[model samples]
Target: MAETNDILEVAKMTISTSIKCNTVRGFIGWHSCDNICMDMHDVLDMCEDAFKRERYQESLEADTYVLVSGVKLASCADSSSGMLTDVIMRAFELIDLSTQTIAKLDAAMRKHALSLIIKEAKKKAFDGWDSWRYELLEKAVCLCDEKLAAKLEKLLDIFLEDIENDYMPEYKRQEDTILRYKLHRHLKGADAVKDELYANLYIREMCIIAVKDATDARNYNEAEKLCLEQIKKEDGRFYRNTPEDWNNILFDVYMQSGITDKQIEQAKKILLLGNEGFWDVLKRLYQSQGIWESQKPILLKELKQCKYSVCYRSVLVKENEKKLLLEAVTENPYNLFYYAQFLVMDYPNEIYELCANYIREQCAQATDRRLYKKVCKDLLQLIKWKGNATAKLLVDEFKATYPRRSALLDELQKVEKKL
Candidate 1:
């Protein structure tokens, strides 16, 4: 019974050795079958008793058979099927093994066993799904093999089509949080993965990105299209609130698209929105359209209503005889002197006479030398018209206020002679 136990123990050890050898050969065969013979030769040199023993010889034979079989399996791999097979083969070849036992194996049996092992490996690889299938497909395209590259291209198109049509709609919502999530998932790189999937997913974000890309590429038509789409979506909400943002973007799109009139119209709409800050933007837009003459009245109106002294002064100095200046002086006589001076250069005798009458009326309430000078100047210019007697009354009133200045009185007397 002891002897029987000893024999069973040896049998178990032999089977264990055989299994180890088989596993190593199968691994190496799949990974580097061309180098299998050399690898096995090196493994055989390390085994002591196994090299001499017939049991060791059997194990070596099994391993060689598995290795050869694995090689044949690897030979059948195409780009789609090769990735997993390559990984399995590499794992096998890289493991530790007894060299001596490998050497004693019959070369022919080893080759056949390797083939059987590889055939089994090919079966396993074919049966299971590889996690890196997409990655493999990508790599295959760079291989410069036209057939494989074309296949990968088709596969990517189908895969992307499936992704777009199948699962992209779940991301569409007015909520920022959900839109951000969709953007994060769908946009992987500069390729715009979502472009193919949905016509308008995270539309605002899409429009912004498309506009930026198109602009960078100098594709003004595409940029304009995206910007217009954004405007259409804005639907007056932009006009009511973020008018500047809307107008600024629209201005850029129109300018880039060579649509000067559209840009000016958008600017006018912005000005009508009544945010005084938008005037500068409107000015720029108007200048871009070469329509500053048309925009002058709008700017002057804004200046007339403006309470800021600096805003009023700035506009008055820049535009000397703008119609709003006349209107402003007529409505608010505090600026009458400035308006009178501006009109001297801009208006002729008849308009000047009207301005003088307005000035005389305002001065009747509170007389100042500036107003007196404006009225006297208009009356002297319009002395031949029937309005000269009214100018004489104003000069008599000025004389009463400043009787000491006879030189000015002498000038008024000379003016009556001209009338």
Candidate 2:
């Protein structure tokens, strides 16, 4: 961990310095898998340098990664003049792109020697509708084709006017759903080319919109039907929209359409399939039936499948809840934070054991003081929650176990007085 931290720290410093001064060689050699997203700001901050050095290809790649690396940025389809503009301008300079390419035959003679870069890009397979490169090229082409640009701008205006005048409210919502469907299909298209565009965000958005629309219209049956239709359509998917989106919408459908024992049980079975954020609704479903205790085991299983222990956040560590916390801790002692923090007052002994046991495990395995310092502070908080001399046991164990860690002891002492 220290080595990893050191490498990242050094990389940040080197990248930052390179950005401060135009150092193309420093950038060309330093960037790789490890340092790609080390700091996007750092990577993007180097665009001007690459562009200045006439490394037009390198400039375009950097701009692409920073601009469209995720769904949130890619879905915008807006952003008129940002990093994309900066890189495209440089590409145009290198290629000497101008309206002459379209209108004046003599203007072709003004092409830069580096115009071959655009020539190579034009050979690559990409859709103008979906490709960021195509979007950039369209903007660059506008600079040279003033008449075409005006027509394109006018068409865009007409399209916006059509949308605005279409429904004002009802059609607007339908357009929202249409946008989500567009994204859902686009993600499928991206999958064909092996691109990673979080299709789930759009899928989930569609489900949420349908639910909202149906509820507002006081048409639960229609909402339920819509949700089921979507779930059927999204039965198989790319890697993005899974457990959370479907479970949330499905749960909503079941509840609004009259949640039955059969439906709740089916939802439980569906949740067991693997999910992320629908635990709350699942819990609500269980509680509605007054069967929460019997259903916790299933909920825990679903939470384990997720990346967080937050599924059990509403559960308290009592007689009935002890096993849940213990199971959570066994999965990740860090889970102790999620449940044990709540246990601090009523379940001090359990909190003490959890803190001491995890701290011991951590002390044995922890080599880096920098990382351990955080654990140490967190342990101190757990110990202080004891608010009695039992806290001393954890303090002594910590001090004796990791004697070299004066920082840990200092943190313990800082809170010891408060306790």
Residue 230 C-alpha lDDT in model 1: 61
Per-residue lDDT for 242 in model 2?
46
> Clashes in candidate 1: how many?
25
Looking at model 2, report the run of 10 residues with the lowest lDDT sum.
109-118
lDDT of 1 by residue, 1-419 (tens): 12322332443354345335544524533333334333333333222224244443333333333333334334442323354344334323321132223323555443443333333333434222222222222222212233333433453344334443533323312222223323333334445554532455334555565676677777877777766766666675554355236456666667666666676676556555544454676677677668878867766666555454434544555555456555555566565444556554564454555556664575455345555455556566555444566566667676786686555565567667766
Candidates in order, TM-scores: namely 0.29, 0.39
Residue by residue across 158-217, what tens digits does model 2's lDDT show? 334545354344434343344334333433442342222233324455556556666666
Residue 385 lDDT in model 2? 76
TM-score for predicted model 1 compared with the true structure: 0.29
The residue-level lDDT of candidate 1 at 59 comes to: 38
**What are the runs in model 1 whose C-alpha is more than 4 Å off?**
1-188, 194-203, 239-244, 275-419
Cand. 2 TM to true fold: 0.39
